[model samples]
Target: MSNVLRIALVDPSDGSREALKGKLLGMDTIWLEADCSRYEFFPDVIEQTAPDVGVITLDSNPEKAIELIQRLATSAPDTAILAASEQTDGQLILRTMRAGAREFLTLPLSSDDLDEALRRVSQMKFGSADAGGRSCEVYAIAGATGGVGSTSTAVNLGCVLASEPQNSVALLDLDLALGDADVFLDSIPDYTLADVVQNISRLDIQLLKRSLTKHSSGLYLLPRPVELQDTLSITDDSIRKVIGLLKASFTHLIIDLSKTYSSVDMAAIESATRVVLVTQLDLPCLRNVVRLMMGFEEIDDLHNKVEIVVNRAGLETGQISLKKAKETLGREIFALLPNDYRTMVEVRNNGVPLIVQAPKAAITQGIRELAEKLEKGSSPAAEAGEEPAKASESKWKKFWPGVKQ
Candidate 1:
């Protein structure tokens, strides 16, 4: 099986088809390789896309759906079939399952329900398809204050990590209403977090990937809502669900969060394997970093998980020295990006990450070094405490909850 599980959608209902397509795109793991209006076309679409699973919508013609499921079972025995309909009848479900469908979902699928159904079907058929999947790392980037380069750090970090062919990265714009993380990479995603929130009921791994805008750097982007009002609809539960799903598929999951604190932001922090606290060398930014560190310290070892990243370092002489910042924040400086407004603006205007547009730039090199440290499982020498030597065991174990090889 490909690292990404390929899927095909067959639904005549325009609303359902479009909704399903949006949801599938939101997922980083499930690839929507085919979409046809009729099950009659499943054979042809399947032949072309060679999907591992067929999400066949069975609302209009249950009998035909059943027939197609049976036929596909016989002809394309390798392809798994999942049936969905608005029908709640136990009989309808039984009929579809009896016809060789691996799973069934009622129509207008909720994200939670779809995710559960797919998980069951995957476990049954692939039996730990993620056994060979990359060891996942999740990083959450937050700025001490707005315009502190957190989004840039998160975007470029994800880009460089994914620059390696073997790595898959998901960069999520969690700034919600005012998020412009996509602007940093110049990605205009068709579906954003707003779409995911609106269709949360029907979201699954495949649907989530469909929502993301894939960048030239091979990093997938889950941008925030376009309409500011839409942000109000997103709940902390949805944030948790989104991050949880991203962790399952991508090798690296980077989140760019809003500067201000919120319930959803806290949820992301709780789930993050590491939090990069991006700050500039100004006094106010340093003060906020100290305050943030205090907040992090309240939680046992959360302070350790947080690594200070000073952006635009050495841009201005006689600024708060790294030594003073560390003394104030009581944590080591994890990374220092050089000030390069020209290179940064150029790349942002071009809609590309620094690593892609100007690989040799100082800021780009800084981001790359951070990525390398992450890959090598090393912490900066100044990082607070001796326990970082054991960080991977404590951090990585949370992502993969339970699955035997």
Candidate 2:
């Protein structure tokens, strides 16, 4: 790969655009390959030119500018984005940086400053640092009831996702009963969720990373309170702060939530980009899934994000059929797993996840496929206000025999 930095710029204003263009054109080492008036043209520009560094102006269009910056960061992780703006206020600079801009420049467009910023951008492209632009997607996992394998699913999913050498995953145990995630991961940590909440106002990416326990597979675990009493000190505000901080540090955040819908649990769920509601096929678990789905229906933002998963679905002892279970819930089953008691028990006793211990097991195969779909950005869950599929209803009725939708 050539060491020369290829660049692109986006500025809506003609005067500022020309000024930036003039400065960038004269640079010796840096080549400016693309420039445009609107931020909308960035992805095409990025694709066509494959710029190592991108400069997008942030001014009156802070909303649009920030959105584009995030899109570019996600769409082209290798590109280092710099947000140039006339407003250099501390708050604006922080917002721009948080939105995934690698460098923020307050503008009258100084050549020396531009050179320095480009130097840092070039370093990012080739450096040992995380090239993901600090972007993350939070997937919240909540079981309908205990022993439904919420922790197993969350921790194993985290491990599977982390198996990708480029992926950085964080697993947060929010059960607040001093969750069993540490036990599941066989992790003995120096810090827990309570410690983060105690110093939440001071928690940043580095500090938060320090508090988490890193597994051998590269998954980071933030254990819940060690003492049951300490769980009382965890508040919703603290959970929100910690989750936000983690989102900035990791590429994928997997949260294991307890059955109780406490404020802290709700905070994580509301913050999640996808909610994985894990349930068994029994009456209680099925009922709980329906109840939770109905409750989620009341919230606009959350209703559409629910991904219903039926764990232990194909066991000979399972009470409900997969088709019938989805019929009872009246939604598509996002994913299903066979009952693998022997493997699950052995792994739990060994304190390791299936992906690491039994990668070829049928259960591991199912979870791995689930991980692939999530990593591929596809969810088979139904949306709010979406009528149950006509085909689904017909098949469901046949599956149920006596039950009516």
Candidate 3:
């Protein structure tokens, strides 16, 4: 045993504390300090012993465990925290992560789990010192509603950026339940955002890269699990930590946000340097866009950072002309993507991004052009009469090859 990995166990039960201490004793390199249940002892223990790790046991109630974690983080940011809970759920896991746990383990603990946690903590300590000058940038994409093609746009945008030689990009799927960035890009990561949250405190660039699923295009995807039952809930702090880790490892970070607003979503949006709000040219879509835009405006800082993207821009609905639609909103359409159901359908069914499968199609061209404009920093103009940028579309062309419009 190295005696370098000092540890602290925080469990109300004396039996569990002794058991945990015994487990640590097996490792030659690990040193067990005080077994404390009272929060009052934490600062004193930490100040005197300076343990490398702190494990909080969540037996009957987790709220106290969470509070202890927050206090420890404030007093001892250097200490790695592992939360052990008898009750584990998406929401509880999220709560633990946000409260400052580096790792969350279910009860009936094993040596294997404890060993892994210790290894991760040790690696985090060393990784931070070796990370050097790496930094990340944030990009956000949101749809006006269901059909604005924000997912597709975000997928391709990340792919395009990652395709650049010497550049790394991470695509974060923030849609808790229905995200398809992983499916679209054909990425199956071993871990999801849930895993990231579960292990957020110890997350450094190296750990983050390990969690990412690499795509052929060189883009890395942090996906939401396919099973909604799987953990997806994340807290603001966990989201920040995940983003912080990505920012250290990648040059570009693309976030696909859920249409519904949540604190997690707000954190991602706030962290982003640019926000692409995707919408379409229909009254219903526009009305929804109006509400979203107004809602965003309520947050003064975010309004200026948002860019409007009009999907399926030129679709004529006889009810309202493109020019009229633009006039209704006060801002210009940042980009206009054409509608092509066949290509979209094919892309979705094939589990491939539209840009990769149909780069020459009109919709693809529009997307590519939009990407180019974003690269250049010029916002595309909305058709006349639509709102300038109400804050906020496209196609299934390939999937339904036999169907004709």
Question: Highest lDDT, which number?
Answer: 2
Comparing 1 and 2 on lDDT, the stronger one: 2
Least lDDT summed over 10 consecutive residues: which range in candidate 3? 391-400
Q: 1 or 2: which has the higher TM-score?
A: 2
After TM-score superposition, the amount by which residue 293's alpha carbon in candidate 3 deviates from its true location, in angstroms, is: 1.8
Q: On lDDT, who's better, 1 or 3?
A: 1
Off by over 4 Å in 2: 1-134, 381-405
Could you tell me which residue pairs clash in candidate 2?
none
- What are the Cα lDDT values of the candidates? 0.78, 0.81, 0.73
lDDT of 1 by residue, 1-405 (tens): 125566888998889999998887665456566689977888888776667788899986888888999988888877889888888898888888889998887778888887766666566556784533333577889999998888888888988988888788998888987887788877778998878777765665667777788988888988998888888888898887677567756878898899877889988887777888888988888877755765664566576677788899987675787777677655568878888999988977887788768988888899988877766655654243465423333322322226121
User: Following a full C-alpha superposition, what root-mean-square deviation does model 1 have from the true structure?
Assistant: 10.7
Q: Using lDDT as the measure, what is the rank order of every candidate, best first? A: 2, 1, 3
Give TM-scores for every candidate, taking all chains together and pairing residue i with residue i: 0.65, 0.66, 0.60
Alpha-carbon error at 83 in model 3, in Å? 35
Candidate 3's TM-score:
0.60
Give per-residue CA lDDT, model 2, range 1-405, as digits (tens).
123466789999999999988887555345566788887877898887777789999885999999998898798988889999998689878878888998888788898888778766756666733332234778999999998998899999999988888778999999888489888889899999899889976554556788889999889999988888998888888887688667656778999998899999999999898899998888888877776765676665586677888899777874787777766877788888888999999999999989888989999998988887776665554324454333323433433334565
lDDT of 2: 0.81
